[model samples]
Every structure is written in structure tokens, then in C-alpha cells.
Target: MPPPPRRRGSSRGKILDLIRTTGPISRVELAEMTGLTQATISTSVRELLRDGLVSETGRGESTGGKPRTSLEINPAARLGIGLHIGRDYTTYIVADLAGTVVGRLRVAGVGDSEPESAITRMAEDIEQLLDGLDVDRGAIVGVGIATPGPLDRDAGAIMGAPALGAWTGFPLAATLSEATGFTCTFDNDATAAAIGEFWLGATGGYNTYASVYMGAGIGVGIVIDGTIYHGKQANVGELGHITVDAMGPTCACGNVGCVELYAGPQAVIDAAHEAVEHGELDMEFTGRITADFDRIADLALNGDATASAIFARSAEYLAAGIVSMVNLIDVQLVVLAGSAFQTIGSLYARTIAQRLGERAFARAVQTVDVRMSVNGTDAAALGAATLVLQDRLSPRSLASITLA
Candidate 1:
């Protein structure tokens, strides 16, 4: 037996989110954790079960009474599409409600290409990916796009980001939605990665953390008390633009000695080229940042002193920026994510941890937990997909209030 369909409310979303994040929970536990009455929990659970968003797993231990049924999210109930538009490549992934990547695709980036054509091509790529999956397209609630930041979230547009040339002021969300026939939403890549981590239960019991994402540039995503910290204009984490050296080269963002200029993928590529010119490293430049950076990373891994030094220097600079971020945010956990960290994630994690232990302002009070993303390089894309699920299933709100 199921309850009749009632008007959707914020309570239902919160209940569903709890099941997704901390599932196999009994109705009594839900009521206890949410501070909602048994009747309210029952009503919400019934609605969730009727909507096929949750399922009764099995009977739980009896507490001197009838066995309680545990509830969990139905991963197959709905799906979401996530796209990470990078300067070198675009990653597309389809995720279930559990934040699991069921399918994925990678395609050429939108380098100097017309935004309209690039977006249309990306839509086609998404169609190609969906066609290969054995799932109903209607089950997909929407698409979430993660790209370089300075985004106008309300307008669903990408501002004039340096790495994303020719995509300035483009109504990406609306256009992609029209092209793909699904509602689309957009956010900063770093923010999306952080949200994805949170949605996937990567933070464990910790409610506050920061996601440090490195792609073509460096960025940070802050999650405070289980919610993303989207400052004014939804562009809060521009860690790359933060000045690390007062006299270093100026960045496209007009900040001198910005961390990104020294630690981002482009910085690695530029440093590798310099090493090649100096006849120090014997690797041919591919002119493509991804390809060239891969070579440098390989050389560094293979004990090339100059190559390793380039990466080490970059890590040091990035560490300084992260130290500043941790000091300001006062978060305990920091997650390293993005394509740029794929080959050398552990190195960055180790370096950042060491630096934070020595330099963080709160070192005396608490040590910052530095680790790599569970989603690996696909974090941003997977996070983008989770954004769709979060938007449709877990609308953000303050603490859940007790139901009358």
C-alpha cells in the first residue's frame, strides 16, 4: 500500500537526500535524525516509495517489537547527464541517483570554435552516448554543465573566462537544453566537483570541506555545513587568480604572480617547453596542452630531474594558495580533483598536505586532511551530473525543522 500523490514539498526532498546519503535507514531513524514526527516521516516515505525514488531493502533487527523496514534510494529511479567542458576536452557522463557514472564519453574541446556550433556538436555527442546506454532517455531529469568559472549562474551563462575563449556571455544552459531536449544547468567546474564529492558521500561524516580542482587552471570549491558556498554571483572559488608572488608574471585575470599562472596545466606546458629549449628534457612538444602535459608527467614519473622539478615547483606554488584558502575557510578536509591531477594526484596531495601541516594557520588547532578525489579525473564531469540529481532531488535549505 502507498500513500496518494500529494503536492511535492521540501520535506520530501530532504528525506530523499537522507536516504541517498545515509541509506538503509529505518523510518524511526529517519524521524530521529530529521527531528520530524513519525507521521511526517511516514508521509514522506510513502510519497517516496510511491514515486519509486526509494525502496524497502529488508527487515531490520527488532527492538522488542515488529521488525522495521530499512529504506534506500532507488538508483535506477532517475538519471542525470553531466558535462565538463574543458579547454582541451569535453567530458560527458550519465549518472544514476546514487552518483554513479553509468556511461561516459569524451570529445574535442571548444577551442576557438563558434560557441553555437560547439554546443550543438556537444549535444550530438551526448545523444551518441545516450544511444549506447540501455536506459530510457525520459528517465534523465536534466543535464548539468561544469566549465571554467566566472559564471553567471542565474543567467545560466559562462562569463568571459580566459581559458574558455569565445564562450563569454553564452547562454550555455538554455542552448544546451534546447539542443538536447532536456533542461540544462551550469556551474563552476570546481564547485561541481565539490558538490559531486559531497553527493557521493566522499566527505563521510564531515560536513565542511574544500575541493581543489586543477584543469587548464586552478580553482577551489568550498562546501560548508553540507552545502556549497556559492558566494555572490556563484563565482566564489577563483583560487588560481590569487596572487602567490608579488612580482611574478601577470595572469589573464590581471593578477600578478597568480597561482594559476605558476601551477596550472598551461604553466606546466610552458615550463616543459622551456626545458626542451634548454636541451634539458628530450620530449617533443605536441602543441596541445593535454598531450604535452602528459609527456612531461611521464618524464617526471620516469625520474627525469628537470621534468620532476617543473612539477614540484608548480606543486609548491599551488600549496601556497591552498594554505591561504584553508586559513580563510577554516575547513578540515581538502580534496584534490580534476584532469590535471590525473597522472600525479598523489604527488600534489602529498605536497599540499606537507605544506598545510607546516604553514596552515590552524595547524596548532587541527590538521587539514588532504586527499585525492575518488572520481579521479572525471570528478568535474561526474559532479556536473550529480548537480542534476541534487537540483531535482535535494533542493538546498537550512536545517530541517520539526514537523507538526
Candidate 2:
């Protein structure tokens, strides 16, 4: 049997993508924007119109002789799904081709659950959410799953996640595809969050950038030349496990004095709990660590010396990690994301910016921009959705799949 023919880019696809991103444009304008002839643009636009992907909304003002028709993408033409899997919860959302979320479902965490059980529950939840929506299932192009590292991108299995125990080596993408009967894409949560910011957040137009995700652990995703740089094994950006202090503390990844051990949410909670046990502060530490971090951030914001000191220590470790990243990658911007960053974001921003300005290798050449992610809690999930959109609509940059 002969191999199936390769799928190449079609003129219609290119024109449609242009209209989707920068639309309400006339045929002549599209030709000028894409460097295609007027006849080619007209034919592509006509095909898009016939497929219900583009529509003529109105008439544009005449540039020379007659008015031209304005073309725009029909956002209702297709849909995509994004799923963010964290230790505490699983977030599911449906978005249109334009990246507008139409539905959302947040399920309570699946802590310590076996991989199969957790994925089964997640698949059911996704099905229920999709069934409730009025849109046709055919409109859903694919699903994106974002989780912590280290991951085997080709095998679609999580190598090991500190928070999500018993998930290591599970065939996540294959299992989900079997259950849902739709193509699935899996990526590191931080990478997904970074790309999410580029597609839907405020980090656009920046050439080089880093997205720092602080959850149960720390992860960094780097973007250069508008493309994510995943090194060999798709785990190049494991910034959390980098050794910061040779004698600081033992990390879950078996490394001594890693940054995550000193600055992750667990570290903060451990410090707070120790303080509470020693008659320092009257507070509960047995509950959720994130809530505890939020409390600490609130107290610090309100001028509590103990809380302020704790956050300062955390920020210092985070700054050291940022300095290492800047020196190595030479990124121009760093964005903070996840719940932990949201709590003490301003402190992190100030501390990292100051340290980078003083110590970065490229400080004399270019200023490194550092700030918190505008997407906040929704970054990972939204980025997951973008994976689907890219797979279905934007094919040039999609990650190639390797079967097991």
C-alpha cells in the first residue's frame, strides 16, 4: 500500500488565517498584506465564503475607484478544548477558533489518584461539559492537555510530577484520545502557559521572553523568535530543579539546594508552619498550601513583618533562578504565572527586576523586561486550548507527533 499523501498549505488556509488574525480587510488589501495577486486573493476569499469560514460584512471606502468588500472570519465556524491538570484541580474550557472561551468547568483536585482513574474522571467531566453545550461536537477540532514535567513528548507520558503522584510514565495522550475519540496534544504546563500569553495575553511583540510558572513546583518556558524552544527530550526549561544553594535544602527531584526546595509553595508553607508551631503567628497550616500562601501574601501586604520576611526570602531564591535564566537565555522579558506568583507577584517582580538589572550578562546591551502574566490563573488552561487551535487551523508551527 502507498503512503498517504502529505497535507500541504492551501492558499485558502493562508488567506483565512490572515483574515482571522487581521480581518475586515478588502481583497486588494489582503493581496498587499500577503504579497499575493488580486485574483488569488479573490479566489481564496470566495472559497472561504463558500465554506462559511469568511463573510463579507460591509464595504470599505474606495482607495482609488470603486469600494471593496471587507472580509472577516466567522468565529462560529469551529471550536477547541483546553484542559489544565494540576495537583489541586483540573480546569476544562471550550474556545472558538478566535480563542474566545465559551464554556468552563473546574473540578476538585485528583490528589494521589492513579493515572487511569484521574484521566477517566477528567474524560467524563469533559464529555459532560461538551454535551451540555449547544455547539456540534464536529466543531471541536482537538484537545490540549497541560501538566507538569518532566514529560515524554513523543510517548505522551508524564515522566514524573511531584504533586501528581502515580502519573509517571502514563500514556496520557493515547488514553485520552481513546476515551474522547479526538486528537490530543500534551505539553508542559509552563510552556502551555507561556504560549497562552502569546496567543491570548499581553506578551505580544516581545522577541525574547520567559514565562515562570510557580505552582506546587517551579517551571520556566522560554520563547525566542516567536517560537518555543524545547530542547532535546522536550524538557529544556526545567528551571526549578537548578541548584541554587549547595547546602540549602534537599529537593524532591533528589537534588540538593534546588530553587524549588527553597521557593516553591511547599517551602513557604513549611516555613509558615514552623513559625506557627514556635509561637510566632496564630494561624492554621494544615489546610491547602495555596490558601496559606495567599494568607501570607495578604499579611505581608498589610505590613506584617513576619509575613514580609518570609516572602522576601522566597523572592530572593526566585531572583537567583531568574538571574541564571537571563544569563543563559538572554531573554528580554520574564512573565510570572500560576497561583503562587499571583500571591506575591509584585514582590517577585521588583526583586527579579532589580537583580536582573544588576547581574544579567546582557544588562549593558539590552534591558530585560520582567512582569507578572496578565492571564494569571487562566494561562495554562487557555494555552492548552491554543494547542488545539494551532493543530486544526495553524499547521505550520504545530509540534510533530511521534508514535510509540
Candidate 3:
């Protein structure tokens, strides 16, 4: 998603940017492509080569002159770790400079646990994960975390994530940094999913898209011109809390009619529990929400009408959210990601696509591509890893760019 269209500003940023976007190319080509003088290109390339960011990858065709040496990124030079602490599970991954995941691990169901205990365990896991890989500790850029948010990203503190109440006000990034001795960066899972999709996902080349992430809650990660829409505190992906029914139950965030209150997995489970309590539907439950949700999803998949209806009702609320998002953002693509979509994803995808086709404001001139993530449920974790790559490899301005 990076290597900006403009090649004149930030010479080193531009050179590395070109190498990333254009693939392996010679100094002559970089100079010609970026419109920078040969001397400037040479200087920048030398610094990059010395820093182990770029490598001479062989040779290129000789255009009536000597064959030029080709250069490309050294993917193994730098490594990054991305972690997502979800309600149902914790996913961790290590990626190299190319944003390719080289290692991964998972711990099931951590949202209800204490933040300090969960993080301490995760730090130990990182140490073990590092030992299995051949990369040096010095080459590690840092750790990137994607958790449910309304967090203070700069302060490394989490706030307002209802499921992570114990994590509220916890110094997440700083704590992880101190425990691991590597710098850490954090962002909401939704934005992280969008970043991962743009950089390493099949959603490549499509700069403007929305990634609807479902976990403990639902969020919309909006990407425009290859850049994520965010600020220092949090992001604009709280579309899950967008009001859909003014009369709906109040959310912990103090909003009534919030989409998550009606359509999130928890909402669906709560509805099912209510149905059971009222004797409207008969279904086995373990008194655990996670297990109950899984049971309901399996029943729906196996042709249980009641279970199917539950998902349908939830999808309706979610579609209302999609409609609002399209009307406001006018995006042509919407991707579904996160654990909530792990089972009945097709139902949501179908409902969203159908609704957009029927009612999206831009449907007349543009069609929305509503689809599920090809990366499966790991979109957020992989995207978390990309955060470190963007911060370490590309200049802040270039990695997230507005292209013409």
C-alpha cells in the first residue's frame, strides 16, 4: 500500500519506497523512475545497502550499455511481532521486513482474564517463539498489538473496550515493552485488519476499502488511498457503535441503538439465551457464552431453523450498519474479518451484499464488493505485524499515502 506516487520528497524514503513498490530494479532504473539525480540515488542506495534494508539481487538487461545491478529488500533483515488479544483467543505472529509471517502461536480465550496476567503469559510466549527462530534479537524491530479499542494508543493504555474492562487504563504497550525489552506499538484490531489487508492481503491494489472486523465487538476499519483513517488516540472504526435503533438496549459505552448491542456475537448469544429462558426455542447450552455461540453456529450450519433465524436477525442489524457506512464513506469494497465471522460468516456476507445491492447510496454508480477475508481469522494478527513493518521500513508519510 506504500511507496508514494511522488518521488521528489524524502530521498531515502523515496528510494526504499520505490524498491518496495516497483520490485527489484537497478540504480539506473530507480534514478529514472524517481526522477532523482544519479548522485542522490547512489547515495541513498548506499545507505540502504549498508543498513541491510536492500540487497543486490543480481542483474538487469543492458540497454545498449553495461548490465545494471538489481536491488530489492532484504526481507530477513528486520523482524516484527503482531499480537491480538481477543475475547475468544489470542493470536501472535512474527513477520519479516516483507510482511511475510514466519512464525505464529495462539492461546484460546483471553478476554475475561486479567490484563496483567494475560500480558505476562504472552511475554513468556514471545521469548519461546523467539528461541525457535534463527533471527537475531537485535534485528527485531518491535511488537505491535491489536486489541479491541477506544484506547490511548500513544500512552499504551486501553480504555472503553467493554470486554477488556480489566485492561482499561492498563499501560499495555509500555508494559509489553518493559517486559520484552523491545519497543511496542498498539492500535485497534479493526484498523490493524485494514492495514494487514492492504499490505499483505489479496485485497492488494485496492486502496480504498472497509474491513468490518467482528470480535468481542464489531468495528469498521476504513482505508482510503492506501492509508488508514486514524489519529493519536484511537480511530474512526467505531462504526459498530453506530446507532441503528434509538430504542435498542443501552451499550456499556452509553449508546442506545448501537449496532453491536443488536448484531455482535455477544448480542446474538444474549438473544439466544433470552429465547431459551422464555421457552421459545429449545437448545443445549453450557452456560458459557463462547460455547453457546459455537453450538448455535453449528446448528445453523447443519440446518436448524431457529439458529439460522438468530443469525438472520443479527445480520439485519449489521446490514443497517453497512448501509450507514456506505452512505457516509462511499467505499466500493467491504471485507469481513475477525472471530465473530469465523462460522456464520457467509450469512453475514450474503446479507450485507444483498442489502448493499438493494439500498447502498452509491449502488447506482458503484457496486460494493462484500467478501470474507482470504486470510481467515488471522487478519487482525497479521495486520498487527504490518504495523511494525510500516513504522520501521517506510516513512510515516509514505506507508499510508493518498495517491493521485
Report the number of backbone clashes for model 2.
0
Worst 10 residues of 1 by lDDT: 395-404
Per-residue lDDT of candidate 3, residues 44-112 (tens digit): 999999999899999887788888999998888888899988766788989876668899888775657
The candidate, 2 or 3, that scores higher on TM-score is 3
- Which residue runs does candidate 2 get wrong by more than 4 Å? 1-17, 31-47, 400-404
Worst 10 residues of 2 by lDDT: 395-404
Reference-based TM-score of each model: 0.94, 0.89, 0.90
Cα RMSD for candidates in order: 5.1, 3.9, 4.0
- Among these predictions, the greatest TM-score belongs to 1
User: Residue 186, candidate 1: how far off, in angstroms?
Assistant: 0.9
Which lDDT values do the candidates have, in the order given? 0.86, 0.80, 0.81
Each prediction's number of clashing residue pairs: 0, 0, 1
lDDT of 2 by residue, 84-111 (tens): 8887778888887676888888887677
Per residue, candidate 1 scores C-alpha lDDT tens digits across 1-404 of: 98434333377777888898789999999999888899999999998999899999999988999999999999989999999997788999999998888999988788888889998899899989999999988789999899988888878888889978688888889999999999887889998899888877788866778999988888888887666777656788899999988988877887799998888888998898888898998988777787788889999999999999999999999999999999998998999998778898878899999999999998999988998899888899999898877776655421211111
